[model samples]
Target: MVATGWRPKAGNRMPSPSRLAGLLRDGRFVVTAELSAANSADPEATWRRAEVLRGSVDAINCTDNTGAHVHISSLAAAHLLVEKGLEPIMQLTVRDRNRLALQADLLGAAALGVRNIVLMSGDDVTAGDHPEARRIYDIDSMQLVEVAAGLRDRGTYLSGRKLEQAPSFFIGAVENPFAPPLEFRPLRLQKKVRAGADFIQTQLVFDVPIFARFMAMVGELGLLDKVFIIPSIGIPRSARGARYMKEKVPGLHVPDSLVDRLEKTAAARQADEGVRIAVELVSAVREIPGVAGVHLIGIKWEEGVVQVAEAAGLLPRPTFSPRASVGGHG
Candidate 1:
């Protein structure tokens, strides 16, 4: 179940799910892995990541310097990915960007045939490599949803110019199903819905029954049909990786049993075990009612994500490699 609560803003427009709902019906889960471009300016590495995902997943989600990890700009990656024939979902991070930059990126994504996007306030700048880097939160995630939707429907850019054709995108927002105060999860999601989010991709969800309960509460609010809920599953690799996630990432929790298993296993085999667990998680969630699909967060273990999707039967065997599509000047 999903919740709704978005309000119209400047150039007010009615909310609709025409874009994202179609992707959900397509039946392929959107696998979101961090693009490892060592340098944000290099578009080649970003293209390679998108190419690999194109072979294994239906859509590629690019993060805006996710957690300050190494990568290209989320918008750049999304643009390249769309050009490479894969669906692109740009992560619209409001933090560290001005209103103009946000507007440009949104228009850029739309121009490139990226029909969906995910809005996020973003992780603290301290979480990134350059701890001293400054941030510019000109608008929060909810405000972003309102602004993007408003502009898209009005057939004009934020600058008030007419478009050859108004760009349309299926907008989404993040949700944490395992919040400390579970009661607030529904209300919070409701706010995003009212803010014009067409879909929701939840934070790392491990406990299935708890997630189901959260879905039930969302249903009680009578917004399920109006919104699509896609839960994200993070597949852990090394002990260092698991530890760093649990201790460093906000709004993320790693279960003890899985951590114990990772600790007991050999370092070289940890990624394999982690992928197996992720496959199990996805398989279980597929049976739950009202679930749209799983969004896999592979971190740096991209190939392991392919294995997890294969194990979950989300990808077909003997997949074609998109090698020719990468390495060209982006």
Candidate 2:
């Protein structure tokens, strides 16, 4: 059963809540995919990708200026996904916006029919191509959760201003269990939960033992009953890609054994090997007691997302209620 206060009302007359939210609330395993907005100004490309992923995954996540390299805004991309009849998890990062901008975007996104949102602190501009860009983190991701939940439940903004109508949103946040000072990771998750995170999507996790330890800690803290936990998994398309992630990415942890497996495979077959490894990870993660679901991050490898989900036995997604609110605009 879903924790109290998180379940959507059965009699809700609005478009049914997002399928992703409903599944998590019902204690059902879910599969979500991430779609990177193209660097170019073509919305069609993103829509086509969402079209291909249709019915294969529960929801598609639109990243917000990932790596600080500007692309289509996450809200715009999410809107396009909604137009295509796909459920979108709108990613909101705190790196580039102040409190006012963030609050405005939140309301605007909800008004445009986005129901699911993932809050992130975001990567520094130094990590992206534009090192000269100014960084503006007026509010971190943890606080953003509090603000969002206020808008949803209290019908007020962070400033205590009441709204004529509150937006119904399924709040989400990200976690990096493999990050340094591993012992404190679960505690960090607790903070997010306290701030009103309904679900958590972790960073790329290749070390099962480490992730298992993280989950164990979460269970110990009784967070397993508080929020849905979904760890992110990725398919390394090439040996070079694997190496870059292991070395360049700060919080991501890619096991050396997996990197070696990719190194031994031929370049042409590396993609297939990557998919196989991802499938194995998915199957393994599902067995973790507290894991509510899996989020596949198929960066630049869209087709692999389908293959991984299907191979991991996550295909043939459970039927969502037809009465389910299509999108929450009000």
Candidate 3:
């Protein structure tokens, strides 16, 4: 059974006032891990994976049709995590939903006690298994952030109608620091902050120096103080995996040096090297001035997250008072 007091009911005791938000506000280094929904109907595997990350992570991020492939809904997956006494960061992409659907889902997620949300303009359908699927772009991610913030701050919808009970969500947005036209990236982040992003999670960052430069630019613009910046860290399982990420994935910049390091390592030991690299990156990133946290994306290699967190000295997360309530319509 799930732990007591972690249930999403109104009167149940809360462990903390949203661990991610609290950590960011208190200037503490935060750690979050992504938990993608399984393609199958059974949730046992997903729950088991989440169980392993309980004490090591601050929040579990539920992906929304990641890579445009359909899976269990992110909202449903987040609800499952909540049932298991784990905090979930619900990801909502604008690729499939219109304004009405988005608003409805936001309200439903809030009712289910999901406190954090990551907004994105999802990957194109052609990139997924179902290339023939029709795409919807009713509103982009920026507008979605504005819409969510409007509900929280002003108790109103984008249409100017006031909400009787606005959903309180800790808004988040995704960034690709290694994306082309490098200089424009920080400007894009500033736009999201202006649109009301409470935090920003970046894409897989293998180029530490480039990411550091990006952070420096962000700090120069004074955007770091406006929003919590969490760089995404990935641990490739093999040299082939690293090569695929560097060559195939758009907006992902896995440096050639990392690839060479992985290639030179014995085939059996490549995974270990990946973990070491992740640990090194985490340690290096922790020293960077503007980084509020690290979001570890151990795609299919969940156990590696534990190894990286432990090796990087990010385990044994701080415990907060149970008196703090998480997400709700304020």
Candidate 4:
């Protein structure tokens, strides 16, 4: 299938303003993806994965040692992705870094043409390749968001040091609505927003009713007007893939109906059926009030994600045109 994707022209040392911010502020439906992990020495491996998502997503997220697994630095991956002509939502997790490292990297990202950043409290080291690695909790995600906001808005550091030029950042935070204590999820989102989050990307969504209720509470709390909400949906490649998400992934509610549909299909056709279900899920996510967009994450079958985007009529995605200023949601 032909992948129709748009990329910000790469060449100038000067970084452009954030297209992701502009699109969301203009009331446009944004499409983003958590790019498949890349670990090769060169940028080709990452670029190829991004190529599949380009047509469907407006911005691609580079994970930060996801699941505590080690890979190339998220910053390096993001810089390479920028060079490859793709926008990178560079994720900064507090799991491995202290406040000093976080602040420096945040500034470094701005200098390297990365305008979108997401703050996350990542998984423990035991979850990945290095169980003995030390954990740093000098600050949490909310504090990190505050620090980023200070740099973006006031041009000062947590130490009160001043900068000649502040980095323009479109800050983001992640939330898990599918998890139990659902009511507290929106409340935490409110705190994140107050801490200077411009947008919220929810955990993988499978149960629509639960998400709808979460959105309703978000609306009731009057947070709908404060931050953009983008729900994530993983494209399962087969019945087995769907079952894995339900059984293996924590805090996710994958209904039996979805898994059953894919399971009953022939093995050869299950892949195609997976795409169909994903497209339908995207459509369902769009109808809910206060949903700014949908983020599609491809597990191992990145190609299947491309098909879902095309099948859902998500091609010719919103152009990545930089505005003069990265607008603050605050």
Candidate 5:
């Protein structure tokens, strides 16, 4: 795959808002995967990832500088996916943009026919190569969710300015159930739902009990019906990769037993063992009471999503019929 750079499409608009929204509303177990680290050297980068995920995942997540490293912008990648006849869950992070820039991108996404936006606070600039870079968190994730909701639900900006056409956004927010003060995580999610998060995506979860407990609390708080929950599972390429996530990635945990299991396997077989473990984790999470679906992150190995989705029996993703174009940019 080659790297690429881009802006929004000139006049590409979809007939419907978001296919993921329709699937969640219909109670389908949606599958999604990250389009990993798209760079600027190749224009075909985004589609290459999407091609592997096509028909295997319900939607692809165009990440916004995840790990705080530079790449093709998430909005641009989302636009590429849309142009490819694929659905993208575009991510928006406040680490490098003020509210104005953030809101502008929200409008830009709507104009491109990209309907879903997941709000995030983002990783620290230190986590990336440019350690000295500054951050501009004009609004946190929850506040950003509120901001997107205003544009969609109220057709106005945070300044109360009106829009001729309101954006149709299926807003989403992230949570890490494995983080400390675990009990408070549910209460935190409660706040996001109140702020207008239509759906929830979580950080990588290796411990099923932790995720199960988190969902149980959400269910007990009456949050099950308010927001759809899609848990993320990160597939390590090897035992070394698994160890890195446990030791380096903040707010994520990799159990010793899992790592040891991978280590016991032959060197070349470790990758397959990791994938086997991921498939098992997917199966386990599927049995959780409130789960709407799963989001798999395979780093650079995009095909793993297809393999896990099929092994976990989430293949044959459903299709949608977008309504007649609102004709904004047909």
Candidate 6:
């Protein structure tokens, strides 16, 4: 119903695996929904929303300047979530920011006890609708993940200096299940893992069957055990949302049927249609074997995300009391 949930109970083991992907490894679903608001200042509002949703979901997924349309950095927003006591999987955009800034952000996150991160190459700066914006790419997304993983693993900074304490982040990367020739996605995913990626989240997934096939291939790679893979799905609200994603966001494609649905829905029913589509897609996502959970991207539909979660049967949920469960196992 609300964006932020209740403060997580103390000493609950913070959920084992710590990373978004690892959280989903045990066959439990993990949802990484986006709730970052347009304004970057004061994440408390969205962070609170994240807390509320975290109860029903495994992890909260934040985006980094998603599609470069408008919004605060995903890392900033995720830090806000962290401050609010939610486990946030922040997206690291490896486009404009350099390695130094990225490393700093990582340290800041670790200092705040924020674990779990998602690395992305990010959309082109020119794509931001701000033609005057400059793009600074020191490294690609995969390279960024590799660097972060090495630092987190080796207790050293990129400069090769040992740190007082190495960060323990659950590093994640992205993939597009709908990438052309789809055959190449597995190889790309493998490269990321070999480079030290612990888990992965994929691009917008519209077709469950296509995603199932992607999972089957993932199983073949033995990655299911070593790395966690979850797919992303967006809640299309306006014709503008769909249009922007289709025409601007690289590596993201909205199926025609959904577009057609949006086209046909009356203005008054558009919101309901969006919720129904998200619920149906999310419900289907949870059923995918090895799927950690669904990442709901409802940038403007913050409240709508709650409705979708409820409709998807992911809410009215129990607190994730790892201690109680661990004792039960014992």
lDDT of 1 at 28: 28
Clashing pairs in 3: none
The global Cα lDDT (0 to 1) of model 6 is 0.69
Distance from true position, residue 46, model 2, in Å? 1.4
User: lDDT tens digits, residues 108-139, model 1?
Assistant: 77776676788999888788787887788988
Instruction: Show the lowest summed lDDT stretch of 10 residues, model 3.
Output: 1-10
Prediction RMSDs, each to the true structure: 7.0, 3.9, 6.0, 5.2, 7.3, 6.0
All candidates: TM-score? 0.84, 0.92, 0.91, 0.91, 0.92, 0.84
Comparison by lDDT, 2 against 3, better one = 2
Instruction: List residue ranges in candidate 6 displaced over 4 A.
Output: 1-22, 43-54, 321-330
Highest lDDT: give the candidate number.
2
lDDT of 4 by residue, 117-156 (tens): 9999988888788999999989999999999988888889
57, model 4: CA deviation in Å? Answer: 1.6
Off by over 4 Å in 3: 1-16, 321-330
lDDT tens per residue, model 6, 102-193: 88888887787667788888887677666577787887888888788667767788788898877776677888988888877888898997
Q: What TM-score, to 2 decimals, does candidate 2 have?
A: 0.92
Clashing pairs in 5: 2-42, 3-40, 3-41, 3-42, 4-39, 4-40, 4-42
The Cα local distance difference test for each model comes to: 0.70, 0.83, 0.82, 0.82, 0.81, 0.69
TM-score of 1: 0.84
Model 5 ranges with Cα > 4 A deviation: 1-16, 322-330
Which stretches in model 2 have alpha-carbon errors above 4 Å?
1-16, 322-330
